[model samples]
Target: MEGLLTAETLYLALGMLACGAVAGVLAGLLGVGGGIVIVPVLYTTLGFLNIDPDIQMHIAVGTSLATIIPTSISSSRAHHKRGAVDFSLIKIWAISIVIGAIIGIAVAGQVKSPTLTAVFAVIALIVALNMLTNPNGKAIWQSLPDKLVAQPIAAAVGGFSVLMGIGGGTLSVPILTLFNFPIHRAVGTAALFGLLISLPGTIGFIYNGWGHPSLPAASLGYVNLIGLALISPVTMLFAPLGAKIAHSISKKALRIAFGIFLLLTSIRMFSGKLF
Candidate 1:
């Protein structure tokens, strides 16, 4: 315990707190709950700490999902209070999402770091394109699929979200809005999906990663307790603020901003892997 109190660790803790704050705001604002921000940051942080490259991306992704749990809950509640969340949709999609999340964990555990990186880059690019094309919240499609059709899509969202270390918002919001759901409502509903995806995903990663080598101190499998402790509270504190702002903003402006964010993030992640 004493050894963990070093200045370097303290700086890392501060960095985690900063990341958490940003993630919380993004969770509330974009229904993404910071997993998008958390994964790459954790990957870099772990590398700086000299954790092995072989498992660093896995640890980063697992830890990001762990952090998303509380962030998503807080953001969802804020959105729910605004009457923006669709609980009925959540009920319909929950089971399928959980199943997908479990499948994602299995796949992630078997894959290599570069493979995971490439997957993230591709997903991010696709999502960015989707957002870029629909900045006004216009429905590209007439309606969302019925429950039967939606189940598989929901599962895919869950699986992909788990694999990418994101809340399902990056995919879910775009899909929902393309089906004519209001952007704010889609964002709100996506927050719930994030929770559903992260909880099971985090548990699966922890179990799968148990006894693995090169994990940082205080890590439970790939989930780092120190990171969670430092990040969760800060995220909870700021999420509501983001929700308030999201509600007040113009949808067109917000959509454009979020699209640009996704584009930049995708490019950064892709560059890291490619270059």
Candidate 2:
């Protein structure tokens, strides 16, 4: 254990813990899965650690999902206690997300790091813009056609989850809200969707990276076990605190801050590879 605490390892651990704490709080408060906060941090920190650039995105996404598993569970439970979760919706979407995650993970493994980075950057930009334009539950409960609308959304959530290393909350919450669901209910359901996304996403990363010699130490495919182990507990512990904070702040302010964070991270990611 002491040996594991190299200067680089310790730095990464501290970073992970801090990130987890922040993410956990936000997850609890905003009903987002916290992956948006986790992925860029992981990518940047892992790059700084001198891990191979070729697999950096894979590692970042996989590890992010790994952390999400526990974090989502804790977050969902908290929301469930408050009667926010919609069980029926979750049951409808889980199957599609699971299948989509499997396929997405497989595709992600075959893609190059540069491509993945670019993709992530674009996604970050889109999220930032969306947050800036619409920052609340105003779009919730808008009413859409029944099963026809849900299937594609569920599949898309799964694909994006694997690609972005998120629990689908970023997409799920907004969509659910658009369909006229309450903001709290949408958030809670998104948390449940995260479970479906992470399980298959984690497995896919492991399976895709199996027997790949270039993988870093303590890696199961693109997923970094060391990073996940160090960060998850911290994230789980602090998520409720974030939720409390969320309740205290205006949704618009929170969304704006989160948007700026994503934009800056996305720019940094783009610049890192370019320079």
Candidate 3:
């Protein structure tokens, strides 16, 4: 085991620490689980370790979902403390989101890396478009839709979030704002949904990838414990700082900036250069 810590590995570990720091701030500031950043980094990390190409995306997604647990907890707690959370919406959306996440986990296990990569790219494209086209966040309706419509929407958010290894904020925050909810409240509630999605996503990925031979060291199934250990605490520490930033400034600029990032990410994914 001592032999495992090569110079390259040490450099990778430092990169993950930086990734976690950035992810934590994003999680709190944007209500995302930082899975967007974490997934790609973990994917690259696992590939760098010479894990099988076939399963690398799965492991990345699973590990990213695992990391989201702490990120969501820290971000959500910060939001809750600030009275930004709306439990009523959380209560309404919870079950559907869990169901979608379960289905996503099952499907992820059955698919190959290319498919998963495409899913991420497509989802990222959609999110990027949303952010770019509607950064100002105009409401589509004066109020949220009733349960029948709302549940399906929530399910989509959860399912896509799991597929992309993202927290619900990537989808949920925009949807909430479109339904006329305040952005801060939308971000807070999305943080809770991140928890809902990650809990099931982590377990399902673990079960799905259990005993896979190509997984890296310290892996519990596809969730790499090393990555988790290295990333989670750092994210927790910085998430509150993001929350503080979110409360202090308008997100329109950040929204546009992130949209550009997502756009580049989507284009990169679609170009097949990374895969």
Candidate 4:
């Protein structure tokens, strides 16, 4: 407990709590899996703490995954209560996601941090642009061959989720909506998909970072156990509050705001300075 009281520790904890609150609200409202919010925040915070620049992205992704475990559960449950989840889709996508996550983590371990951050930045920019352009969350494709279509998309989602430390909701919701699924249902189902992606993604980071001496104290491989523990519960507690707000907001307004926020966050991350 005394260790948790230093100025640095107190600031980190408070900062994490604030990030968790914003992330929880966003997760509930946007079905975004909160990684967009969490990743940049963690990265910036770690940067401030003078962690190795080379490992910044790894820490960002790992810490985000840890936070998502609880955030996803809370947001998913809220959406579930509103009858939003498409369990059938989850069943179809789960296996491929697990496989992809394993591969993604392995790949992440071998890659340089600059490359990882660059790739994540590109993806985040694309997602943000897509959201801005498609506020209605409409589908581009009405239908497709189930096995062929579902498998590839699921794999892609898993791979990206692990690489970017996102919950897959950013990609998943758009794809599902493009397939003509209603926005609410797509959001709901995407939330569940996040669980599948995060579980294996987190494990992959753990395995990938195993025995790395530079890893901070209280870390499990790439995963920051302390950061996760500090953020998860508060995120869970505030998620339902976000859901209630989401229900009241206009979809277009929400999409625009979130899109802008993502763009700003991406830019900040690319700048490589802690704010």
- In the order shown, the candidates' Cα RMSDs to the true structure are 2.3, 2.8, 1.9, 2.3
lDDT of 4 by residue, 29-140 (tens): 7777788788888887877778888888898898888788778898899989988888877888889987887788888989977877887788878878987899876668
Winning model by lDDT: 3
Tens digits of per-residue lDDT for model 2, 169-253:
8777666756767666777778878888888888888887787777888998888888898878988998777656655667567
Q: Mind giving the per-residue lDDT tens digits that candidate 1 earns over 127-231? A: 888777877888878988899999999999999999988889998988888898889999999998999999988998898789987778899998888888998
Q: How far off is residue 100 in model 3, in Å?
A: 0.6
- Score residue 184 of candidate 2 by CA lDDT: 63
Model 3 residue 73 distance off true place after TM-score fit, in angstroms: 0.6
Q: TM-score rank, highest first?
A: 3, 1, 4, 2
Error of 1 at 161 (Å): 0.5
| lDDT of predicted model 3 | 0.88
Candidate 2 local lDDT, residue 53? 84
The parts of candidate 1 lying over 4 Å away from their true place are 1-5, 273-275
Write down the lDDT that model 1 would get: 0.87
Provide the overall lDDT of each model, using Cα atoms, as 2-decimal numbers: 0.87, 0.78, 0.88, 0.81
Lowest-sum lDDT 10-residue window in model 4 = 136-145
Q: What is the TM-score of each candidate against the true structure?
A: 0.95, 0.90, 0.95, 0.93
How many angstroms is residue 203 displaced in model 3 relative to the true structure, after the best TM-score fit?
A: 0.3
